[model samples]
Target: MHPVLFEVIGLPISPYGLLIALGMLTGIWVAKRRGRAIGIPEEAVYDTVFWGVLLGFVGARIAFVLVNFGAFLRDPLPLVFSREGFVFLGGFLAALPVIAVVLRRWRVRYLAMADLLAPSLALAHAFGRMGCFFAGCCYGGVCDRPWAVRFPRIIDWRRGPVDLAEAEFTPGGAIYHGVDRVGDVVGSPAFYDQVKHGQLDWSDTASLAVHPVQLYDVAIQLGLFALLSWMWWRRRTLHGQIFLLYLWLYAASRIVLELFRGDLERGLWFGGWVSTSQLISGGLIVVALGLTLQRRRLFAPASEPAAAPRDPGDA
Candidate 1:
């Protein structure tokens, strides 16, 4: 795992931030093409996606802070400005109403637009998950399997745990010191957990082997993108069909995936029986199912008026 992909003239370039930006651009490109195909103006696509992504970032940040309020309260500014901690479900939820408003103002069918954006969202999410892998965040529980990954420990003076091998560290902070755990040591959320619980130690070079949940998410998102694209092209029967199916399938996948997550900071509720993402996924599944059924009934091709009621006497 490598957080800082490289340095440009002494400025470290973060793979997490880079990949997210790439995902955004890829998503916009996809949305534009799909929009044009479906008669949506190019400008409208740009405006809608731009505003949605901007507000989505704000929402994701807010949600992450709220879930980890205790930590933020203890130390505020650094975490607030940190590049990590955005939650995807929070961003998606925030963008929903904003996109709806944009479409309604334009007098466009919101459901149709949602369908157009669904596959793009999935594809972009796949890229984001790839970023998560490179950053070594959102890791999975320990595993002895052949495919389990070992993240090198890399904690920056101000950034806490980083994924860089040559990250410069200065002497600071009471808990972490520059000279304490030196060299190219493996580290990540998984590493933090293992070290905290005595499963691993600072003296060890790499983290305990763990499941590659980030890659699992990447696979799931890519598969969902393909499935939604197929539905849009061939199997769609309603305006909201593709998007609703996307919500349902992605939510279900998240629910299953959450079980393997090792990052407890993401949020755990009901005595840690469920995660915040899992809870959101449950709600989305219900909403998707209800909307799908309602749309099917209300928007199904109007049937020919059931043959004139009897008409035997008239005949």
Candidate 2:
């Protein structure tokens, strides 16, 4: 609810931006420490993170714009420049190639580097989701439960719950009018009461009462971070195993959590229930498994050792 942290003289400082910065800094710090422990050059880790951040930001914005192109078309400038709308998967995808190229140029083992980064990424995601919670952007639908958070101010925007008038269109192609007060029955009368009173009306909070999917994500990611850290600490006896396992774990969690994401309006293609995120998660799971299997084959020990080559005319 506290979107803005403080005002310096007259300028407002955003809590969301601050939290995101903190998360990034913490993630980088953790990665650098882990990198050194794993024998990676500290400088290379920093450079990789620098490029990763830049590429990740760009990729996240691009993905968000693509997904919500219709909304972006209405106001392109704000949509592009605004701090909101970043997708975690988009950032991860964007950073992958950038990190790979950097590692390749530096002659660093990409798989080992990825393993070091896996836990840090999850840690960062946990903080970033907290930022989202503060910003009220990636919000859950609604809830009447005890843990449910009611953000009245968030619904004041044209895209929020209070603006449900925009969601309803008449058969004659006219936009429906919003009631300035209670007693309106087109939608939920209880919702109308809450809107009019500037309070959360739990009676109509069904779809809105969806589980706090972001917190669920945070909890899952923290567990993943712990698991990856343990695997890395134990050295796993194989390169890339930790990274692949992280991917598998995260994808599985996402697939399950996406079920509670009532905010997504898109429907499944074949069945009654499915999500875009779930589709992506399934793909990631398959890719991770393939990579894990490939790593085992490539890094396996050789059956015999070859003799050193002898130079001509040399002893």
Candidate 3:
């Protein structure tokens, strides 16, 4: 995969980082526009997102490090500065409390703020998954389908994948461990697996065709974004319904998607029967259900309360 989108002034720019930045900026722009309609100050929205993003990055990085602790210990500097390895759930969990604090200090309704951010979160995640696809990270299990994608070899020698390309020299002063038979080769855990299982030979140019799970994740997130946006603008009745729905739906989808994931870097337990994301998603599903039930109790049908103030400036 084309990890480096391009070079600027002799420096490489990674597609993963660029796409994530683009997603964040787009999410912020959309949030600012929607925030105004619901009486949320633009400045408040900006402040909330800023702190959330800053903390989210740190949390994601920390989670990545913890998950790959042995590798981090062996090579700490590269791991710390690497553009890849961020976990979405970790960042999301870390950002929630800070977001809540900002909303409370700004005198904003928590549910309203949650609703406003829900679609934006899905939108951003869809873009981030697209970035993952470009970087060949979060890859999917092998598939015989016509749409399966065979990822390109890792050109960087530091990562330790077979270099099938007939390169005159190797990068980082690392010895070329590839056979002289010139051919294309796949990269990473896929390469390692193929070699171990005899699925790949030195003559191969790419990994075995596999399911494009990252694209599937992107599609799911976009669909969620569309549904949440529609609910936000048209069918929103209860204040917290959209946010709760987002949580429930995404958690459910993630459980299914994790089944197709090929990468083993994400933690697994119970003899690989349960993944970390799957376990987390299961808990989130229960939490969403409970919160939704509790939220519904606040709007009893027997004694309908007055309509909420259109402007929640002091809410």
The TM-score leader among the candidates is: 1
Expressed as tens digits, the lDDT of each residue in 226-304 for candidate 3 is: 9999988888787777888999999999999999987665777899888888988999999997887787675233122
Model 1, span 1-315: residue lDDT tens: 776666679766777889888988988898787666667777767878988998899988888888777667766654577666688999998998988777665655777778878999999899888888887778898888899998866555334454432222211332231112333332355665566567876556677888899999999999998899888778866677788888889999999999988777678999999999999999998888788678857543212221123334531
Two-way lDDT contest, 1 vs 2, winner: 1
The sequence of per-residue lDDT tens digits that candidate 2 reaches over residues 220-281 is 88898899999888756676778888999999988887776644422243463776667778
The CA lDDT of each predicted structure is 0.74, 0.64, 0.74
Model 1 compared with the native: what TM-score?
0.84
TM-scores, each model vs. reference: 0.84, 0.76, 0.83
Clash totals for all candidate models: 5, 5, 2
Model 3: which ten-residue window has the lowest total lDDT?
173-182
User: Ranking by lDDT, best first?
Assistant: 3, 1, 2
Off by over 4 Å in 3: 156-189, 192-203, 298-315
> What's the CA RMSD for each of the models?
9.0, 8.7, 5.8
**Model 3, clash count?**
2
